[model samples]
Target: MNINKYTKTDLYKIANNLLWTWDFEVRELFKKIDSEKWETTVNNPIKLLDEIDETEVVKLFNDNDFLSLFEKVNHKLDDYLKNKSWYAKNLNTEKDLKIAYFSAEFGLTECIRIYSGGLGVLSGDHLKSASDLGLPLVGVGLLYSNGYFQQKLDKDGWQNEFYIIEDFNKLPIELQLDENKKPIIVKIKIADEIISIQVWKLIIGRIELYLLDTDIKPNSKKNREITETLYGGDIETRI
Candidate 1:
């Protein structure tokens, strides 16, 4: 975890924040720094920051225009997180009412490919629409390591499948951290045995999407593979 010395500020935080996923301007700022790598990594800011040359980041840090834009974007994010929206201000129902959305897969974006088909696409659209409407929605889903296989046409026009192994650390998602900045682990009972699930958070504009991953070291090998692929098991396993 040796970060470059030049990243002294909260540059990683601002870049990894899911706000940039929706804000094209802020996303473009990161892309401007490294366009080639940006496209290669599916516009992943965390990956961009990690892989970009140290000298390039240093130059951007010293650039007044980049700094100005960075500060403004950070300020706007602070406001967005702290302030209440129209939905909160004008709500007439119970204040404690909350919506919990559950789906087998969610297609938030193609970059974070935890989706397989139309169901995930529809679920993603629902969350996006919910965010736009300022609804009190929380999404729950499993984090897949190798998301749905990417389809490609071979030279003979036959179908070829390519599965991508995603490095979660390089994505915009964040591990739910406790007061001491350690990952918060949640334990639950399934069947007759207990299992541990690590929670990862993805901020979808106004809403927060939480994905549970069973790929931690504490889990058994069988359990660790639960989140390995999308729709990749038998009927019982799928259930």
Candidate 2:
């Protein structure tokens, strides 16, 4: 199916944003499209959209009940974004001020497993809170290709580790583009080598979270894996 046709619609806009992660009504609308696909995709709307065929998409958009709920959720998101909060009213003088939050991992949602434990959860919550309060805040973190490990037990009662590779295209993230439509790249020096990095942006309500990635072609394989695992590398890799 040609998913590009619906890219300009409100459904695509709502699905692309992380706001649906916290909103039950918005999630329900996605579930209404295909409940089995929704569950299989782990509540990831982007993946759900890709999996549905044209017939399913047509039936869904043509349903009156579905459209009603869709409009309600869309309006809720619009109002939430437009409404001012305490930060706006009290910190009007600090309009030029912006905060950058840095963390090794962020547990924004289950589908995006860039986080591992408690610290990551706390950092994710901080971003969400800041967004809700209308604070001019942005989050910075590394994009892990492996994103921690999935643990399983063997017959001998021992633990085993397996890493799952993430496809960024299926996730609700957008690659940062420059004015010329090229990817915006950042270069940093580590010892004698200069590592090239690309940025991915994830929307958290009104706030934006920028994730740094080093999996570009300009870097060596070793350097490309620098952002591979979350807290799974040696001291050298950690550095």
Candidate 3:
């Protein structure tokens, strides 16, 4: 099993594939449908009365828009595959052992909102790469009620903050559900004290991530609300 960081060549190849002149061919039906939708957005903001007829829909193909959308989708798929491979390489050894991967980062591949920097992206890569390789690794992470804040500093040392919100349920992830189909909760010893934790499950495309929280009913308000802020807080806290 090969395991290492993605090299410059890998990066360049990805870029080249993205920039290639040849695009995925769009089916006539899809082209027609997409064109009609584009026309509706460009011309009719209110979508009054189905302005474009079926016949007109067929003629509405905007080649550039179609190509752009196709490329973006392909890029996303490519990224997922690459990340899946990384995960497979790192943790797929014990086939029969039920394994769960806990990480706080889990970048855009899991949720667009958790991107604090390269760390989340790296964690996402691990999850994706593991999934792609069919590694028996299940991902566990945190979903923010509020997205991570990335601080950017200017030359004058002024800090600028930006937020990325995460919708975990939308991301590809699975959960150990109770009989009611809700995420299963667990009890742990934190600081020599018993604490209960509730988990939230998310689906990140084809990836699976579970988020941990201590805000469940059984826990007291003194339990610190745990969620992804800079992305690694969960793993760090748990460890």
Candidate 4:
């Protein structure tokens, strides 16, 4: 990005903190910086920064109003990250105990539309709330290439379904990487065949949500389509 000039600044860190979902000030700063781009990019600060003009960003960095708000928001984020919650100091759950939450879908935001209906939205809210409460929670779900189908009415009032395949690389998602800096591959047996699943990580505040993708190269054609769409196919597919 040739942003080394501003990469060393704490402003970069603040802009990259997706945890701004939980903070109003930080979210406002990004929006204020460029409301038009913010809306176009689905409130994704990282993408907004990436696509925004570097000259404009440099001007914002030098602006006194932007600098003032940036400092305040940055401090707020630092405090939030360091603050030891009551759950941390008082709650005594088993040290090795970890909570695993599984859901058919999650509607975290419209930008990443891997959800359908209210159940998905509810599941996403649960994960967000759990993270806010500082619970040791993990979410498991399948990553659909074509999330939920978009519905449109035909001339005769029949519903037409269309799917929008999103480019995951451009999205804010991060592929779970191992010590060797390669994607962590997980293998499991399904029926009599061994299938490989690639894990993708999404950050929901302090919590980590892991999604399994069966569309990797190691899987068979049929197996690769397992994670193609949400609520797709017949009862066998559901099973």
Task: Please report the candidate that would top TM-score against the real structure.
Answer: 2
Q: Please, what are the lDDT tens digits per residue for candidate 2 over residues 74-187?
A: 888899899987798887687689899999999888889899999999998898888888899999999999997989999999999999999999999999999999999999
How many steric clashes between backbone atoms does each model show?
Answer: 0, 0, 19, 0
lDDT per residue (tens digit) for residues 75-170 in model 3: 665665456454356766666875588766666422246556687778777765555565666677765656667579999999998765443343
- Badly placed stretches (over 4 Å) of model 3 are 1-95, 150-176, 181-183, 204-207, 231-239
- Tell me the lDDT of model 1 at 117: 83
For model 3, give the 10-residue run with minimal summed lDDT. Answer: 14-23
Model 1 lDDT tens row, 56-112: 777886877776777787777777767777677788377788999999999876688
Ranking by lDDT: 2, 1, 4, 3
Q: What is the C-alpha lDDT of each candidate?
A: 0.80, 0.87, 0.50, 0.79
lDDT of 2 at 86: 72
Per-residue lDDT for 26-129 in model 4, tens only?
Answer: 78988988899889988877677777676787778777787778778877777766777556767746777789999989888776778988999899889878
Clash total of candidate 1: 0
- TM-score, per-candidate, Cα-based: 0.84, 0.92, 0.49, 0.86
Q: Which of the two, 2 or 4, has more lDDT?
A: 2
Model 1 poorest ten-residue lDDT run: 1-10
Model 1 misplacement above 4 A: 1-8, 177-183
Candidate 2: misplaced stretches above 4 Å? 1-8, 155-157
lDDT of 1 at 172: 79
